[model samples]
Target: MSYADFARSIGLGGIAVDDPDKLGDAWGVALAADVPTVLDVRGDPEVPPIPPHATFDQIKSMTQAVLKGDPNAWHLLTEGIKTKARDILPSRR
Candidate 1:
């Protein structure tokens, strides 16, 4: 079951925020709630948690792991590349 479902099962208020843009609103609702609240913020699992400054060895290990037939290899690599690109490239905004 989802976190929201689980929270409701235990008789607490629950809010699920799948969109990043809705995070502030979700927090507002949670904080304003009279009872205890559960804020279930769903995020992309395929996006690897890359450090700000990854070492050459760290990158090499990740690549090797992907090459070894990880189930989510393609998604992980693509998401990682996209995330890195966003950091390296200038923002359109």
Candidate 2:
């Protein structure tokens, strides 16, 4: 099926994706380039590929800023959320 049709059939109604592997690519880009996986850096067998960059305090501060409707945090938080939502969308159907 066309990715769009598959997406719609699966109830991924508004999202757009051209390729399945693109999700992994996007994750790599985001995890490396954009926001970074500031959460959950602990890896299998107990070794992490990248050291934790942001502390819980920093994360909490960002969360608080977001909840308080700070503009910069809004863009940052929504990009993180949208990237994560995109990662999970294909599994719903």
Runs off by more than 4 Å, candidate 1? 49-93
lDDT of 2: 0.46
Over 1-93, each residue of candidate 1 has an lDDT whose tens digit, in order, gives: 489879988999999888856777899999999989999888687666778799879988988888698888888888787767776787665
lDDT of each: 0.82, 0.46
Model 1 compared with the native: what TM-score?
Answer: 0.54
Backbone clashes in model 2, listed as residue pairs: none
Per-model TM-score, in order, reads 0.54, 0.28
Tens-digit lDDT string for candidate 2 (1-93): 344345456554323334544555545644564322222221132211222465667757656766686546655666555544554477654
| 30: Cα error in model 2, Å | 17
Please name the candidate that would achieve the greatest TM-score relative to the true structure. 1
